[model samples]
Target: MSRLFLALFLFLLIREKYGYTNITLTVNYEKILAEVRKEFLSVSLDTHLIQLNWGGLNFENQRVQRYARNLAPAILRVGGTSADSLYFKPAFGKELASKNILPCYDPCNCDMDYKTVETFNMTARQWHQLANFAQRVGWTLLFDLNVLDRHNGSWTGKNAELLFDYASRKSVGPVYWQLGNEPNILPHFYNRSINPSTLGRDFLKLSTIVKKYKAFQQSLIVGPDVTHPKQDMNSSKPMKYLRAFLQAGGEALDAVSWHHYYFDGRQATADDFVNITHFDSFKEQAKLVCSETRRILGQKKSVWLTETSDGYGGGVRNLSQTFIANFLWLDKLGVSAQQGIELIVRQSFYHGCYGLLNPNLEPTPVYWLSVLHKRLVGTQVFNVSHNSGSKIRFYSHCGNRKSSLVVFGMNLNNFSVGVNFGKELAKVKFRVFIWTEDLVIKGFKDIQNKFVKDISFEMPPKSIAFVKFRKLVGVQACK
Candidate 1:
């Protein structure tokens, strides 16, 4: 017995030195912190400023709607760069107005007058169609109102009021409103800037319009909707903008909103997706936002990441669309929820380089990962810790239905590693599901009953595993 104990200790010592030991994952089921909100995972769409009719056309497609419905009970945000300059046509059935169609050398800035700015028109029929689709898919519409119209720095509320009036008459599914997209960075793209006080005043004006309508009275008003923070002084910093906006219009906001991207798409790589440090940095940034929100709004308001993908600028062509993106996607879900973010709106559902569904309306690897996350992980988030290296990242949540606890692990290393659940859980039966290279999904049966303390399995390189335990002994949180 003494010799056996010595040998086991030496084996563990050598494995630890070489970083080959089984990762001991500890889940404290009793330590439930937050109830993950049902709408925590949502999606957004680019409206192309209502021009090109991208928003109206995409949701109407049967295949697109069907794929979206799979992730039901989500928030569908319709806005992007185009939202900042979107124009409205209030006259019902009026012929669509034509733009000057300037041929500017710079794609970012196409200088034009107010008449040309109203490039896209959302007819009454299209509005009704979008509303009906939202209702059918069990999603709420988060419509972005243009703040940069001819009204100057302030929102005139004419087009917004018209939209609300139409929505109320049609009884659209609970429509929430965001003032604009990436307001902090507007100067860089549109050569226009609105001070926080001006934005606050505009929000108040919109709120007054909303209160006049019966259907919109209870609708949420979320904003600032700024881009992520930047280190450079020349770039826009969302936190600084958020502080100013909250001070000026803090009373008007229902939720604080912002966007995040891991890196620039031009330089992004698959290795970046699996790097644990990259996710750690993201968590720190989220923490900073959380701290700022508490300082400004106390506990009354919640923070939301309204637009985020693996990389900005449409995301990397191959990395963002392939199976490796799941590592970043899943990690974002787990870490964001843990950091107290109320919701995470993925940059897009479709119609972008980083879309979860391809142009053919087929599910991408990220979409499959999302389906598994929604179906397996429940509302309650449990505490999970790891004793191994950074290559293995672990998260725990209460199971969806029959299962008691769901454990998710991401293997970032190039080699397989074993995962041990400790002796207390050795006898328990677990169902395992894996997503790896080429978007392949595989499942394995229960671990053999003979194992006393740990279970050894080869978690392939750059893979993720979802392990569900049948029952937990005394987890009141699961109940």
Candidate 2:
């Protein structure tokens, strides 16, 4: 009896030492649920789109440009809170006019020169330079125009006319025009609210102005770029504002646009950065927007999440810039695509705390995640399922170019978990990319030769992996 007891203890210890909880993932490639658009993994460029100099050149540092080029087929939106206050000067030596500017907002105010209206101005020459830069980087510009002209109760088109004229003269690339930024929250800053009817009329007038120039006529007009509608007491205003805007001007819009942030920057922590539940709120917001747009327009129009990130106020210090943020970033992309969102423009490319690149234009973990997403995930989404519960989330997509299927999995557990691809893909070798806590990307590698019917691999705690099956069976979508 003593010998048997000792043997049992040794067996249990060995099992605990090298054991891994098995997880099986079943993917149905035949179900063609949705098509992820080519411009799915795009980003936004805020009002501080470029660093301008006195010589009127809009420039990006070489490092910034190099990092940006990796994430191509991207959409760059040049608008934010600063956009509403931007003063566009078409020519050099223009005298500073008092009426041309307004008080810059929170983030912009910190660096603004209060004495001159030129503090947040962008010259026409700078605009041309920006256009050239966009062309070189394979990005399409979604430029915003100032609409807070107090001289008229509605939007003013003077600066827009100048921009369009300059673009036409220089033969700049196509620019999607967004009239204003977050009109719903304008009341909080400007202490004035332009009602839906007034805004619709303004959009009509702006549309007319855009048509005057051949270059502008070819561009899309998307607007009422409102803030996310909240569920609490403060929600009524933005919700009502959107309903009214859609009712009045839904016909004029080529696409409906809005913004979202998972948490408030001031209160966010590292734990909050990896919390998967935070992503549910974003999906709910997308559903609300989709439902509202369909009801107002009598059909579903293309919806664009023009600006978004983990936290709103420039993001939390260590959380947004670290490897933890990749969980939120990649999950957001997967959820946004599943929710039928046409395009999701990440809040920033190279500005603010939530930016993919830091102030020095160095790539952050999120930037590396974006690069991998662009390379692995394609425009077609496949149905993926796992019984391992919420701690392990799985998303699959058709490969971008090869006859392959890409599966992205996030392991939020502290201990290592094993993922089995099942008998169908068991014999197939996978190209795996793992994003770890140290922000190091373990490039693609094949599993060992021993596993023929299943591949059992250990996933580190709080990490994400991208696995590509070189030739997945019955995935007609990739063909």
Candidate 3:
């Protein structure tokens, strides 16, 4: 079947089999004197802030900058597929000889060296420029190192130390240092010969070299930032590498970072745009990995969803570029909230599939949603529940400036529900946020970009919604 068919089939199967709710309701104040507590985690953008370790040309975008500034407490994951290009591959043929000296290392063909002082000078200048950029934005930096540098153990501790010192000296300290960008899976895609155990050893070596620099003391070392595991460890998977890291007593690193993408690579759904379970699944996986890593490390180090997106590659060509991104990108924030995770950054704010803005920097529908979550949600509170597995998840939040209710309405059974808050919820006012999908057939983008007019709605089957709340002007009895 086509990817689209698979998506539809998956949604149907989920609704028919694993869906949790059968009812949903809309409510007004004075009906439920429910006490909601403020429970928002810190917000940050996973800045792509793409870098060039090669000829030292950085493609910095002002739109991305504006996005980051608008979303403060941003985290910039500074590597991508381009991360592999330590230097541009040069051509020896007479046809096109203007090849830049490529950065050759193990498992990669980065064998060329600098032929001119200009290239070396350019690299140094770029690092400084990137450092300045991070400090200006107050970015929580995540430096994904070039692991291929040590491919055949070519990049010894001495060699790795040079790069680390260069970064520490030129750039502001990296808040988190991921060993490599999903190395476990790179072997299959890049034709790399490295295995999980080798990946682990290299990580250790990289960590050691990075620590030699004095500045690394202030920065945290996080590692194995493995790509999403295949269902059955089909390729150079991370599970074994991680298992080996623990067996080796991985005390050199401080945290474990991992990536996740929820949708089937082959498909997209009309309601797929509206699914929040993807966020839940990604967060859950990160949570599980974090739990397992902590168990292995025998310490309470944090786990970071350092890199994640909706589609596998550049993402499916669909409404993901539109409003569905709110649900798609909400994983960055909602997952953090769900797991009490310390930090989670989107894979790339502007890469092909995961980017929040277009090449022109037009905000995707998800960007606005991210803004709402960052600005509107609270920072600390207890668990918010509204009956187990009901289509609507109600959260009551109270804080210095506001008290609110957030209802996550999910519909799958083609059913409606009348929900009454318990006596504990009567005093709150309702100000809902809507998240229903544009009703479409399973395969079409029929209503992908559209949503309900308001939070008040009869949630359609196979749809999702988020309704928020606030107390009325004169309800001070709780004081």
Candidate 4:
């Protein structure tokens, strides 16, 4: 695990300008995590990443770095629905009982747009572009197999397998596989009402055939990509079918995959993303699925988030730029890490309220926070103490031989704090940054305004700020 670093501001004029604000951070070099992480950890992403089709990576060919960096090597996940549309062309659309393919959209007839023509004009080439980009960036592939094949109620893994072979033919390392996006969401997505047992059976069958491919020995097979099995608000609970699937010889599967929306549903408000207390409500949901898997599969397997976004369906504009979004992302990451899961793939690097970065490749507040976390927080558990006001909270990462204090304080109100970090005085360095306004799409001033020069300032009405500190051997500290 790496500590995420947040860039406060890089002065264009590289000479350390004097009269700079002395924002002090306290670090205790004496304590570090006792349990060293044997393996380095990072994120995993869906096939389509930020700046790709949905977010338009080459839309303008802006050629900025990070939006693409968001998906490379560090994370690998397949974007399901988007891929389903292209790959799930119904060869026999009229015969299927389900209105759409297993994961197809409302306008099931789009198949003719591409199916009628061999070129697949309707396919989201953006995904191909994404895979190409990932490949170019030295990434591995885990292309999602088609669950919604065009011939009604029928599906095949041939095209998908071939697609993976095509996508990563020139690349190195083991390829990964997932039969469907989220099988639990299958019935609702395709307008079919199959129970979990049927979905599981289908998944098992799909996995069985896929494993026969030559790549099976070298690739990763992940399944049971469900979302919210606890309430079963709209689909069949996977546990029932999962047991049956395994009973029917689905053991060739390598990993358990799924999705999680902070609060189930889309287009939610920022307030919805910010409420951590609501998470307590989902704990039992996590427990149930984990326990079920343990009962059937065994303990200590792998659990991954194939998809997750704070607000729904990409989300609205400003919520992503709010204090709420900041707290929400942090809460999610902390929870996921603390849960001790194997990997967590963020919903997207772009296109949603929870996008770590924007379509233009600029870092969102959450992106900065995410970077900060990657640079500072490690596998070590640190004991922390802080006050929980409506917006601000502070905590310290307790390491066995070194400690780092992270104080993410939200000034939702009119006041600020001047704090003290114990006897580790004169051993801290600071990095501070701020997000003061919403992202404006069509404003000239929005693009031309001078970057702020002030160091200490009031947090704008809904903005979020980031300040980080690295403890050194001889830095001075506040009394």
Candidate 5:
């Protein structure tokens, strides 16, 4: 009896050990979790650029246009904390002039010297340049209006009407609109506090203004952009604010939007980027937002991660700008899709530490990942289940090719993990791409031209992998 017991214990231990090393992934192709927007992954530009007069952007630069084109079929969001203070000089009334302005020396001398930090000005010329640039880049423009402009504690929206009137006259085309930027955190940054109910009424007024313009008739309105739910005195708790906003004027919004960052940029460590617990936190936050939105507004209105990154304060210095950041970015895309987020606008295209490209317009690891995602993955997502638990994070999607499917995931383990596809993907030919921890890409070759009975591969530790089955047998969903 003792010998038999010892043998059973050894067998069980061996099974457990091998099971963890070899992850088995199965996808339910028929069960589509969600269909992401065609412009699912978008990018944003901080209005701070215009407020600070940081040379704005050399929209004429070939390199800049080239990189921007790569992220085409996206929404170019013009918003940030500075957006709340932005004033359209074309429509600046005498009443707005009474507010104290934060002055600065303009480096470009774009005639922006007269503005203050509390009241930065955007000229008509700058507006046309930005609108033209968005048109030229084949991107949809989502502009955020100044919500802090008030008269007797009510949003006047006179400036927003003037800006929209100018755009309509110029035929600037359709523009998605938002009322503010991170309204929950306004008290901390701007010493201004507007409750959610008041903000909702403000949104209703803004919606009325937007409808007045012929050019914006078909445009979408999204808002009450807030950060993750946090119980801090500096900001309104995001969930509470959102509920109040929706309750007051939920019908005014076309979509619900929010922002997220896994860690604070100033205090992030390299290890924090790859922490599994941190990823779980992100998932939980997303789930909470989705559930709350559905409960309040129902499924009619979609949710958006309009502004997000690795860390909030301009991103982490070395960690966010490195290849390690792909773990979070990739995981974010996968999780966002699963949670029914229609759109995720990455913070910036070219301005900060979190920018996909450096000042020189060179690609980062996340940029390449975006490229691969755009070229290979489709809108329809398949439900993927893996036996290796959280050690291997996996997502499956219908590929861009005819009768094809793609399985992409990250291996968070410090040691390489092996992947074994289910029988449904057996006898399939695939090409693989693996981005390693050292920022080098490996494994781009096709396994074989002929069908393989069983497909298996090693995922390098702390790396991302994409396996595309050129012709996934018996998968009718891709059709």
Candidate 6:
């Protein structure tokens, strides 16, 4: 049988396999809460990966290209902690070294003794390969520039200018730029700190450099990509740092960016993935970031969650790679869109345990969810409210199709919760997507897809579902 037929067969096979209940909830789609960019869903490539020879990406592999294309028109961000130390070489040869800095072989092994600067190098050939791969896959490139390459506590921009000149000469045009990665925590990693004022100055200098190159003239400059904005002992308060950065370099920036992670991989548990409180924490952080951006930079600049994932420290092995992690991943997309974030870049698209695809290019559950989201969810966000309590999250967005809306959510409760989309959607057809508990092992074989005519249905506990309301009469926002 064909693949489509097989998918359809499996979808039908599990239609009535799970039980149902009468937990009716409501959806309010009259207002558009926020709108996101057409290219809202994006992925990030860790610099360590490129330093580690593509980190097993194998862009030459058809499967790799195919999987990547599934989420096309995305922003492929080449950044991470290693971005601060990576430099572009003019040619392919022995890697350059400076400040007694050794070329980074292992991206994860960080030296706690930060008396001297550590560095990594990539050749011009590798740079072109990266651009070629992104072009082939129809992704926009967002390159993060090195911030630690400074002289007299000021950004030199010499290395960045060389890279720009190379990209321009090589005909790689129109890549987005970020000056640094988490400058608030710089003191911890490099035993150095670029105060927000200095960071702002650095960004301004980077902007001037960007404008000099014809190829990078129109590129969007986004930064100061800091961590979550909260008071913490380990790093500068991101909120205060962000405010200072914007005050100093707001004129140079086109957008605001930040990173977020729900749990520390070293200390996270499987149960944390499904915790409603953790999801709420992300919602709160997103709100604060959005509000801060608007307060400082005004309403014109967009906010981006440039780097985010479930577990920050290389991700928790089995938990991050398994089916349970979708709870946090799916909710993040929902909350970010609702809170007016224009783009979200998932970190290490193919590097660590949190990768959407493993090194061999085999997809994790979240990869499939991302595919579904890109294919089904549209840029128009609708204001959706429900009385389903904390365990159930409901978000509505204009469907990819005209006059259609897709309402998606995950049931955190161990028992099924019935949902009612209200009388407004009483006659619409529902397409339910719920996978079996063995999703990580069986892949799509465990996915259940069926069209239901009923206005209400029960979603199995700990399961995520996407219901597309087709044949809708009126949803002004969708149109």
Give lDDT: candidate 2, residue 459.
74
User: What is the Cα-based TM-score of model 6?
Assistant: 0.89
Ranking by lDDT: 6, 5, 1, 2, 3, 4
For candidate 2, the 10 contiguous residues with the lowest summed lDDT are 442-451
Give per-residue CA lDDT, model 4, range 242-275, as digits (tens): 5665554346466676676665334455566546
Candidate 3, superposed: residue stretches over 4 Å from native? 1-63, 87-122, 151-160, 170-175, 231-233, 264-266, 271-284, 378-381, 388-420, 435-479
What TM-score against the true fold does each predicted structure earn?
0.86, 0.85, 0.68, 0.63, 0.87, 0.89
Candidate lDDT (C-alpha), each:
0.74, 0.72, 0.50, 0.47, 0.78, 0.80
Rank by TM-score, descending?
A: 6, 5, 1, 2, 3, 4
Q: lDDT at 428 for candidate 5?
A: 57
175-249: candidate 3 lDDT, tens digit per residue: 566555666666554555455566666667666766677777777777667767766457555666667765553
lDDT of 5 at 66: 72
Query: Clashes in model 5: which pairs?
Result: 102-116, 102-117
Q: Lowest-lDDT window of 10 residues in candidate 4?
A: 105-114
Model 1 ranges off by over 4 Å: 1-19, 55-60, 91-119, 150-152, 230-233, 423-426, 439-456, 471-473
After the best TM-score superposition of candidate 1, give how far the Cα of residue 457 lies from its true spot, in angstroms. Answer: 4.0
Q: After aligning candidate 6 to the native by TM-score, how far in Å is the CA of 313 from where it should be?
A: 0.8
Model 5 stretches with alpha carbons more than 4 Å out: 1-20, 54-56, 91-116, 229-235, 439-454
lDDT for model 3: 0.50
Question: Over 4 Å off in model 4, which ranges?
Answer: 1-55, 59-64, 70-73, 88-128, 150-155, 164-169, 193-216, 229-250, 263-267, 282-284, 321-323, 380-479
Error of 5 at 435 (Å): 1.1
In lDDT terms, which candidate is top?
6
Residue 76 alpha-carbon offset, candidate 3, angstroms: 0.8
CA lDDT of 153 in candidate 3?
A: 52
